[model samples]
Target: MKKRNLIGIVLLLVLLLGILPISSLALDEPALNSKKILLIDTASERTLIDRMADARAEPASLTKIMTALVVLDAVDRGTVSLDQNITASAAVLSDMVEDGSTSNIVPGETMSIR
Candidate 1:
């Protein structure tokens, strides 16, 4: 079996073992982070607790949220047309063309953000 499949099965089994939805658990307790944590009640559209949430070093995972927000905002404002092409700037390429992290975009490549 592929490593990904094995990991997925393990995660699925773990999920199945838990009855309560993950989102509910967050409202019941504060995450033990001496660093940073933010809890939001999605159903109520409110923040339950926040602690140094924005003070951390920017992790690569957080970039996806920023990218999603930017894309959503652009879409909502119609600033970025669906047919428009965006060239990967050299700066963006240099930042992404690293071993550990990347957007997997090469320099000079044109991407349709739509």
Candidate 2:
């Protein structure tokens, strides 16, 4: 399997097994670092743990993972290549937050998509 796919599976497993189990075990206890978190069983479509599920918060690193997944999907479909060099344009840099996490690329720096 591809490395990206393996990484995605590993992340999902860590969420479903490592995090989800501990999150739902305590309702009276209030201890969490995430602004928004939710775990829903895909087979049954049941929500297991929901914390601030309706709140709108900046995604931070989650967006990186999501972008990787989308790009990997495109690569699998032959729509995008891992060797392609992507240059960050001004419009892309315009979305950056001063104190928040964003891609480590500058507006002009170019690097392989991989």
Which candidate number would show the highest lDDT if scored against the true structure?
Answer: 2
Candidate 2 least-lDDT 10 residues: 96-105
TM-score of each: 0.46, 0.53
lDDT of each: 0.77, 0.83
Off by over 4 Å in 2: 1-36, 41-46, 55-60
Q: Which tens-of-lDDT digit does each residue in 3-97 have in candidate 2?
A: 99999999998887865666678768567787678989999999988988999787767788899999999999999899998887978788766
Candidate 1 — worst ten consecutive residues by lDDT sum?
93-102
Pairs of residues at least 3 apart in sequence or in different chains that clash in candidate 1: none
Error of 1 at 59 (Å): 1.9
> What are the runs in model 1 whose C-alpha is more than 4 Å off?
1-35, 38-58, 95-100
